[model samples]
Target: MKKKLVMMLLAACVMVAGCGKTAVSDNFQNSDAKEQEEFQIEVESKIEQEKCFLCGDAEDSLMGYYSKKESIGIVHLNSLYVSETRVRDFDDDGNELFQQGGSSTMVNSFGEGYGSVAIHGNPDRGYTNIDVSVSDKDEVDFELLEDRLCQICLDTLADFYEDQINSGDNENNGCSGYCLIDFQTKELHRLSEPYSGYTMGDYYVKYDIWKEGGGSDWHRISVFIAYLPERVASGN
Candidate 1:
């Protein structure tokens, strides 16, 4: 797959143990050994002009890579290791229910914001098929998230096409991708492969919003994005 090949190349270039990297750099071609560690471009912050993708913890190895103030809507995993999981359905009072009908520890979530992000298996395939999620938060706007995902899909598709044209590869055989979750509709929406957004799913861009998790706060709005590896590795 294009994403896999790109990631392999990236790993070779950076000498990282795994295939995880952040998207702070404006373009991929400019990433160098030193720039990858120190951060590339300086993205402007939304809450305050001073806030930035690089404004967060500096010591956190992966989280600090391309992450700034917070993980996108989904919490960022500190490492690139895929979490262990089990997705099996059983009967409840003689009625069979989807294993995902309820939450499980297998979500493979990382950090916390309004909610954390998780990925489970598909209703059909066991571990092979996966879906991502954002744990329940006091406040969430499904409509807004849906809209933003649509826009991101379009942007990603555009990038894919541009890359294809530039590379003169008309064939798209290896770029199988994942779909985004629509909290409003409670359904899966196909996300264009290699979303234009950050690869780690740990940065909260403009489309992502989070409420403080302090004393008393209600109106939960946490989103769990299913599917990884695919989301992280774009075919570009």
Candidate 2:
């Protein structure tokens, strides 16, 4: 009887050990499967949210142009005439930034034709060149006006950049470096290092509208240009 009891106790211990091992194995397998499922979901979500324009493979492209000339006013009255225009395009996902279109002009403020007022575009940022023109009168002050215009261009470009990044069009893509344009000097500068800061996640995505004028007197211009990531990557 004693021997049989001992044998029964041993068998019970064996069974418990076997059960524990099986439970552990099952738990590990389940955990692995769950992890794989989550990873796949993440990839699929990115793919779905990716913008076609970022890849430059789109059916439609955005284009813009601006021109100003002495339409009906005297040259002196048109002191603030802007005859040049340019457009900057960023990734629909907002990772890439660059300028494309540009314009130029000539102005005469006091019956004396200044050399030429040419607003050149930065090859990278699309910001206009230095307001270059010979001074017809030594006292004609243009610094203030030039400063104001440069500020406008900078503000417009910055707003456009933020809008594209916030649009829920792509994932795993963003402005890697600090991208900036100086309109006053017509310089394009990009950081050698990548951008490191807080970013808006999937749940809090929002759309932004950038405008130049206000109220009923405002004109809506879509300066947002869309291009595929591949094309933009190629620098085309």
Candidate 3:
């Protein structure tokens, strides 16, 4: 009975040792795997930072924004007509008085003005009209704004085109280019093209706006823009 008990005890001891060895081995493997994962993440983050630097980080970009005090409008005229008629007012006793008569002018929030000539009393007849409006405050600085907007637009368009190219959709490829307008000069230039070896893309970021229609109408302007090169680059 004593010898049988001794053999059983030794078997139990061997089982406990085997379990301990397995537990230790598993812990080491888990820790090693965690370290490797952390290292990989660090390496990837560094790569991304490098890419950001190459792509002209936010500091080195031009940006644009809609002027807060400005609005835009569009007008369409089909014909030239004018008429002067006394506007009448009627009281309970069929009385008539003269009201001011000239022309009706529509002013948009941006201070743009539109006037249409009364070709006839009929709305169907088209008339020549003048569309004018105060440009956005940003318009005065349009050259700067344009460059920034174009650059950003190019970057975005590039990404969009690349995605489309990958998906095999290249229908509007010509629209991929960027354009900057100098309101003062009334000049429009392509981002890819350089005037005096200074391409707009090199100086400005991109911005986008959503206008309702092509006709002359006041539009809500939304802008996303960047700054001219890095302030650090400018030493300011």
Model 1 worst lDDT window (10 residues)? 36-45
The C-alpha local distance difference test score for the whole of candidate 1 amounts to 0.28
- Model 2 root mean square deviation, Cα atoms: 24.3
Prediction 1 TM-score vs. true = 0.19
Q: Write the per-residue lDDT of candidate 3 for residues 62-107, one digit (tens) a residue.
A: 1111111011111111110111111112233334323434334333
For residue 6, give model 3's deviation from the true position in Å.
69
Which candidate leads the pack in lDDT? 1
lDDT of 1 by residue, 1-236 (tens): 11212212334335433445743443443454332211111111123212211222223222233222211212221221223222223232323244454444445433454323244434233222223332333122222222223333333333443443334322321121222322112122322222323332321111122233574332122223332323455687
Query: How badly does each model clash, as a count of residue pairs?
Result: 21, 8, 24
Ranking by TM-score: 1, 2, 3
Candidate 3 regions exceeding 4 Å error are: 1-66, 69-154, 178-236
**Could you tell me which 10 consecutive residues in candidate 2 have the lowest summed lDDT?**
36-45
The whole-model lDDT of each prediction reads 0.28, 0.25, 0.25
The deviation in Å at residue 178 for candidate 1 is: 6.4
